[model samples]
Target: MKKSVALMVGLRYTGAKKSNHFISFIALVSMIGIALGTIVLITVMSVMNGFQSELQERILGMVPHVVVGERGEGVHDWPEVEKQIVQHKDVIAAAPFIDTQAMFKARGNTRYGLVQGVLPEKEKKVSIISDYFIAGSLDNLKPKEFGIILGIGVARSLGVSMGDKVTLLIADGGTVSPAGFAPRQKRFTVVGIFEVRSEADSMITMIHMQDAAAFTRKGQLVSALRVTTNNVLDAQWTAYELRNQLDDKFYVSDWNYTHGTLFKAIKMEKTMMGVLLTLIVAVAAFNIITTLVMVVNDKQSDIAILRTLGASPATIMKIFIVQGSLNGFIGTILGVIGGVALAINLPQVVAFVEQLFGVNVIPGDVYFIGFLPSELHWDDVILITSVALSLTVLATLYPAWKASRTNPAEALRYE
Candidate 1:
């Protein structure tokens, strides 16, 4: 028999329903193992991709695309820096800002917070802070006027709302008095409340640019120039460009530069997890080797007859290799289909599981995102499939070699 003919016969022999029950059972297990491993690996990769996507959108949306400040102390001319940064191609908007850690008070209540001083009109161009206006407008941020915007959480904590008065206690750099360090306390009417669903809701407060300047002791100069970009990924290069265009005292930082270390760690973790799971599929493939070798052993007499009829060693080898490989190929195809289906419906699947189990699988406080996320990337599936197919092919080598080396005379003599 030619090698092609032998391979077809071998495949038929292995898959024959009336074949030995033991061989069939082992084949079943091998298929199941491959299917399960592929499903798990694909599902995990999808979830990781989903998480990375969500985190990037939210982080970039809420945070500044780039921040330009003084490298040593503070920038004396924030307006000049802002002007230069806006010249970058991706930069959509730039605004002068001063951030201060301070205490807020209303109705004898107190809470620690980050107070942001922003240019009412310009800040809107860069950040969505204006879009979140559940209350008054930024135009109400009149210079030297006592007005403030609070996050919804901060407003609720301080027991105040729009049109209500609150006191901002500048923690430092206020005019000193006989009593103590005189607080630059201003009883400002709450004009707006915004909700970002992040720590920002509790930590962020907004005030007029002039008021923020006086409190921070940065007269006529803002602490940082907040920038928004057309493409968030271009932030780093934009920062670099801003620095290059400006003087030595100025420093620019992009979103990646600020959060690079944390992202690097996540990348490491994802790689390790994929490697650990791939071993499961590899171990499963090895079982195919055992199954093929056993099949070769049980059919020794049949092989001898085939050899007498002019079957070549290569033909015998091709037969067993095809049979073992079919087990891998079938499982892999099924796994890919099932894995992709699960990834596509993961959100609803998670919701169903939660309801069925009557449990909270993902607690909102623990995870930055509330829902189970999934993003199917075809590239990842292709890569995983290639690795699996390679491993499956490798499992056939030893068994195929053994079958090819079978001695026709020795086997037929015993029969």
Candidate 2:
């Protein structure tokens, strides 16, 4: 019954009209601060998650998960190696490729990039390049015809489009001429263009595998067998296992070797941003301490009367704890609701803002994507709420203890 009375008194005091309107205002401010902090933290974390996903899809999609190659000139028996790789349970698909670095020239403009030769039919199973074609289909890359596909950035730099002729100058197996060694130059018709809105768009080009073999004078040899896995995150383990299974002369590599540093940096940035934003919630929690301290000072006479009526120190402490906890709970609830709604619609909101202001918030040429993205996870919301509530509860303890220690005679001496 004493506990019930404590609860009732706490509830009444929280909603009761106070003599000091400034106290009420301070409490309101504290609640608003918590809510604002939560909303910003949740929204920012969701957008960061979105950026991570975009990197995985746009960048990793073009880069193979795993690659198998021989230590010599190239993979001499690529078909047999591809067959063996497909037998692995974790391997989704394998495609032969010939990779080289070359300079592309068109309309008096020259650009340097990686030139990849692929079998169009098999390439589709191991890569997403087919999905991003802005011009002709991958089927246009027929053997011996020397048809080439240019990344959008390379296409723009060369000032060429479909059906235009481009010159490829390669140093591999270059012929010795009167001017020392000369690079092999060949003309190829532009058959397709693809854009992934990533660095790959500026640095990658594709042609028929047979054409690449002829250009490099490797006959039937391929540079490597690109492999796709069921799960991209497990590609390193899969590559390791494949290495153990293959001959010592063969080497296996995964995307982690090339792009791991980039992803790690992004993850670190996300963690730092999360920690920094959490400080905002902590600052708001400090306001709870200030509000509770003032409340203890204002309720000295009431506390004395309660003590005279036989209320124990424990009950007095519980009363203030209840009041402060209620404030935190209400703020947390409001923050979660507002934060979730905003995160789920963040892209649309950004688009609306850009439209209203006539400005491009995310430029395709600058960022991996041309629009804002958001991916809200319930776990982040739960964590932020837990941290906010814990801080608020801790803030209540000192002021509640001070209120409990008020002497009846001293507190009511001038009442």
- Report every candidate's CA lDDT: 0.81, 0.91
Write model 1 residue lDDT over 172-281, tens digit each, in one string: 56777788677667678898888654456677888898977775777887778888988887778877788788778777788886666655666787788789889989
Clashes of each: 0, 0
lDDT by residue (tens digit), candidate 2, 1-415: 9889888998998889888999998888889888888899999999999889988998889999999999988899888998889989999999999999999999999999999999999999998999999999899999999999999989999999999999999999898978899999999999999988787888899999999999988899999999999999899999999999899999999999999898898899999999998899788877888888899999999999999999999999999988887787787778888899999999999989999999989876677666678999999989989998998888789989999999999999997
Q: Which ten residues in a row have the lowest lDDT in candidate 1?
A: 362-371
TM-score for each of the candidates: 0.84, 0.92
Candidate 2 global TM-score: 0.92
Pairs that collide, model 1: none
Query: Positional deviation of 28 in candidate 2, in angstroms?
Result: 2.3
Best by TM-score: 2
Off by over 4 Å in 2: 176-181, 355-371
